[model samples]
Target: MSAEVSGVRIGVEERRARLRARQLAAVDDVAEVVEGLVALHATDPATVFLSVAARLCRPSGAIAAVEEALYGSGSGPGSGPALVRMMAMRRTMFVVSRESAPDVFAAAGRDIAARERTKLLEHLARGGGWDAAWLAEVEAEVEAALDRHGESGGARLSALVPRLREQVVVGRGKPYETTQNVASRVIRVMAAEYRIERRRPAGSWTSGQFRWARAEPLPERPVGPAREAVVRAWLRAYGPGTEADLKWWTGWTLTEVRKALKAVGAETVRLDDGAGHILPGHILPGDTEPAEPPPPGPVLLPGLDPTPMGWQDRDWFLPRSHRAELFDGTGNVGPTVWWGGEVIGGWAQRADGSVVWRQLTDRGAEAAGAVDRAAAELVGLLGGVRITPRFRTPLERELSA
Candidate 1:
């Protein structure tokens, strides 16, 4: 319907325009796409590459463009258009522009690291004779091992630092209790702190099994300004979103969300569900005709694509009935077909490397034809490389099958 600014309703068409204007199109480059959207959701390895492929004017070599920007900097740490895969908001993995990486770390990664560190220490204590000092010592040993080889997997690092191989019990009294080696967990903590990074995996880009390498820590900045910058970017890219949406996306508390919004001088707007915020001075079209929005999209976006996952409240852009079919129980989205600003269907690649799709709702024949062209083009672009969503959903399963 319409969004409210001082009780003035901003229409959905206007909302769609705001987002598309900030997003990259075929004319844009890899860095622009990654930075424009704040970051590309990278929980699924193929998601990052496929997202880029969808936005480029020429899908050919777009995958390489993403790789060059992300791993191109070097096995070592540096920043520019270069991208870094790091854990951010909601503890989900994302590939963000290197320039904004530091602020993202300050705003979200640092908090995640601190919380994870605390939990890890508590787990260590229960294991007996292990504490922060022990963790530090082992972390150093792991780093030293990485330096020796330049890149190493958890298995190698664990062997090098025997302490890493030591077991710790978690969920001690719970039904799902299990034991884990300290190796991978420690590496994750270091990554959260920016002490090291995951380099490209030894296998195809689709593989999540990645290796680790020592990385220069992210440049430090005060949390206040950093959070402000991050919030500003979020509002600019995904604006007119409610506090709950930002809170759910960023995993920040209401206080932190409010403070950041104030620092950015964000303006409150009325959304269908409740109040939302937009960057100051962002003028929504008056009740008159909304500025001609971008043409309807038939782009095929991978599962966990950032757009759908950008907000907790999905009603404005997502069909209510299709939610269960497209999304997993925990909210990760599967490969979705977007016909303009809304999700119209879901697609999956068959085992034979052909793409198959099922419309959750008919979008008319013309839209269906466009969807077909997009799917066929993706088949050729993939060149027979198949993808399986890291998080599978009912519709994707049915379509692929």
Candidate 2:
């Protein structure tokens, strides 16, 4: 029995790649990495796109480095763009351009807004209110915006009528959706366009009051070769996980996930469930090694960060008891702070972009200090050139007060 247990532990370690392969093969090439991301139909390509795009600050010149890669820049530099498009920068919670949010939205123009709002509201209404005339109005506004902005992704919005109509409703003035609903539908539409296989909608999506809610959905089919390539790439970026973990991260079913695994069967190995929570002998890469755990300092991952929320078996990384605090009733995981490999607390960013974190543990100041530095670093990297760090500490009396 001891020998059998020892062998399984060894196999588990090998699957996690701690045992061999000095230069993790999966992480070797950036180009291949981008291709893999594109293939997975990563839930929010914008997030991954912005993340790698920011690799611009890395020793490799950002544009020069990304230009040669498969995902490349999804939105090339342009004059002005819309909030939805500009919000893409928010995926990283940082924008690389000097343009203010208003400027970006202004560039998006009222027409683009009309269309996005139209499409968004339609989904909120759930196939009501949005009509041919409403859509036509939005289309006209979109064309005018294109003429003003001189051609951008927003311009392509004019051509996505079929998809737009499928997801939204054209109704009377102010279509029946709320701000949250609009935000949700925009993400959903983008995911669909990215061809991501899974997107689960928030519970509010069913509430008539909510025109839309951002939740992941399970794609009709696991993404094909190109998309599969991206899924494999995600494993490299965020792996040492089980097949169930991948399914949880992307909202695909076990059956579809298994098929996708078969697609990449040659590159992975199975890990025995030494943890006992997940199935034993789960597939992980034999040559994969855990990335050195991220520095012990605190880092503020954006509200919709893919890291903590990436795997289904979140308890493996997070304490099961505190899960409810971060995950809402609708299953949305908000902005969270990480200290070492475990989550320490929740955070919210105010209008000035100052970050306020509520620690669930005593690591508050220690973690906040690190997150403060990281936020400043990211903000500066995004074109602020210089960003000041400010941490909000909740007073003990205030808790009782």
lDDT of 1 by residue, 1-401 (tens): 12234654555656666555555345457877887789899889999999888888788888778778866645455432378888988887889878898999889888888998998788788854598998999889888888888778777777778998888887788999898887778888898877898887878889887888887567998999998988888876777777777889899998898788777767655455322433222222332234454677687889998888888877767767889999999888999887767778899998999998888777799999999998999998899788999999999898888
- Residue 101 shift from truth in candidate 2, angstroms: 26
TM-score of 1: 0.90
Listed per candidate, the RMSD to the true structure in angstroms reads: 3.9, 12.0
TM-score of 2: 0.48
Please list the C-alpha lDDT of all candidates, in the order they appear: 0.79, 0.40
lDDT by residue (1-401, candidate 2, tens digit) is 01111122323334323211211222334343333232212223233333343222252243234323422233565422111222221122212222222332222222243555556555555545555565455444544543454323421343532333344333435656433223235433433232111211222111112112121222233225533553454455555556666666544566756666667652443444445443432323453434343235555553344455555665544566776667656454655566655577766544454445667766656667776676555544334221111222222112212
Q: Measure candidate 2: CA RMSD.
A: 12.0
lDDT of 1 at 397: 94
Over 4 Å off, model 2: 1-224, 266-278, 281-285, 288-290, 351-353, 362-368, 372-401
TM-score of each model, paired residue for residue? 0.90, 0.48
Candidate 1 RMSD to the correct structure: 3.9
